[model samples]
Target: MEVKNKVIWITGASSGIGKSLALLAGQKGARLILSGRNTARLIEVQNALPNPECAHILPMDLGDIESLQECVRQALGFFDGIDILVNNAGISQRSLIADTHMEVYERLIQVNYLGTVALSKALLPHFTEAQSGHFVVVTSLMGKFGSPWRSGYCGAKHALHGFFDVLRMEHQKDNIAVTLVCPGFVNTDVARNALTGDGSAQTRQDQATARGMDPGRFAQKMLRAIEKRKMEVYIGGKEVSGVYMKRFFPRLLHKLVLRSKVV
Candidate 1:
């Protein structure tokens, strides 16, 4: 809903889409709790906000699911409780399944899927007690359609859709909302930091990702979707068409994905 005066907790707030969201939310007068593993970068983002005083930094590692509840407690203590929790912290994969190590998959799942789940569960009690809260998930277009070199990434994102859909259904009575924001290819370092077969960062940007929508613009669209409490929203360029293709013409989408130079 309206962001003004609302307490919003955003993960991955150091850079990329999360940073963009923090900036935009700050402009909208929302009190923010910014979370990420990079303390310096988080502080940098906070300082860049229009109202840095209204923002709190909470450095956290989403991969560490066991510590998430404690993180949640700290976040709640920041401003009594968070009115919205944005699940935006995640890692990506850039290798074929056959070539990827099991640890790579585990890493992706731990950060992208289980991490989101753990944090959401930790915050669920608060949301239920208040009976008013929003969970905004930043997933991917690949969550809906399979891709060339993002098997583990796709799996993790797809799992988010499943879990959040059920969460929305089960929590409807509590007036808690779930919004899944599926971004196709955003212009960010996600590809550069993507995990490879050996679990090392890809350290290279993808052509398509480099040419994707600007994170600032994407965040604006994302906030609009959250305001409307949409169940799912897709943000990107032509790659967004892939989601619809998968819905009505899976075979065509499959063929197109096979022919496209994803990385």
Candidate 2:
């Protein structure tokens, strides 16, 4: 569970929480493999780390499911083996199910659910061979609950929890651990880049996200969860209750979320 000196692969490391985790993990003496679509931005993150040797950038589109196995192979070539796989690369949705096109849901599933699962499956053999590995999935609070306008996003994240939870049960003997991280809104470009009904970026930031938790602080909390090898960790400021509310007080929470003006 000790992160220091462990090899960690973090997807979506160009910015936001993934970037923050990369920097913090690098400072903590962990070997970091940062992956994302933006080579330039990933390199910038790599440079900002305290120890350059602690981190390297792997630039690729995780949404390209067909190439994920090759990506895993490429990663194995760089280091001895991957001790942790942080599945964080994902897109968000802002359109209602009625107004959304089929493709919007497909894209969300492809990038968030299918892509993560494929990459994790591709790396399963490595974890089994080594008899130890961690799968740290960055799901959303929406995964635990549902939002009115974010049906697709919510569904995809929900699927992730189910998949990883089962993977944990099935791979326990192999010493493989699966951690599902459910974070609420964080201050990041995620909202601005969220997809609309037409498969276009929302381009507008949500008021809630603009005033959400600091990405660095969120990453710090997430790192602690990973170190503990937690089964699941849900973190947020006030919005953390969204998970509990949905579980214990579904009616009140559902009505409140539907009526909330923030979204």
Candidate 3:
């Protein structure tokens, strides 16, 4: 809860929300382990922090499932123990299921869903043994609703909700906390990097995403949720309303989604 002096491991720490969180966490006096595929960029982020020495960059590809256990081992060893694990490394889909190849869906599942699961499972034993650890998962609003042009992304995020929800229930007695963070459209490179029909990046930002919440503001709200140890928190602008709409008025939300030009 108290970020100061806490050992937090943040995946996808090179840029965007993860980078923001890392800087904020560093300012708050948290010892950080920043991980991402871009080693140089991760080091850049570490250097930008308030106390560069307080953060360590651990480059890793979450999609590489075989190496995740070893990654977790290295993560734990960095600070002797990890107080929080932020599952933020993920890719997004920007094409319709009909246009998308099977490989696209598989890649999304492998990187976004399975990678998160593998890392969490690898760290579960340590958390159970400590009986005091937090798993903060950065899912998406798409995880709560199926929208156009994001079938694979939505499915993978939805799967994360199910997994973390169950993890919360199973680990409650163990004193392990699970927090699912569902972020709506945020101003980030996510859209530009979103997977297309052929599993290639979209290379262009969507209008809505470009106008979405600022990554720094989103990160601030995210840290608040983590501090409160909330079961789940949705952070965004008007798009966040969609979560409530889907909850109490699914039919209405469905109609709106069908008519709205999300892209």
lDDT tens readout by residue for model 3, 114-138: 9999999999999999989999999
TM-score of 3: 0.99
lDDT of predicted model 2: 0.91
Stretches of candidate 2 exceeding 4 Å from the true structure: none
Once fitted onto the true fold, the runs of candidate 3 whose alpha carbons sit more than 4 angstroms away are none
In model 3, where is the ten-residue run with the lowest total lDDT? 90-99
Query: Residue 153 of model 3: what lDDT?
Result: 92
Q: Provide C-alpha RMSD values for all models, in order.
A: 0.6, 0.9, 0.7
TM-score for each of the candidates: 0.99, 0.98, 0.99
Candidate 2 least-lDDT 10 residues: 254-263
Q: Point out where model 1 deviates above 4 Å.
A: none
lDDT of 1 by residue, 88-145 (tens): 9999889988999999999999999999999999999999999999999999987898
lDDT, residue 249, model 1? 94
- A best-first ranking of the candidates according to their TM-score comes to 1, 3, 2
For each candidate in the order shown, give its overall lDDT on alpha carbons.
0.94, 0.91, 0.94
How far in Å is the alpha carbon of 66 misplaced in model 3? Answer: 0.5
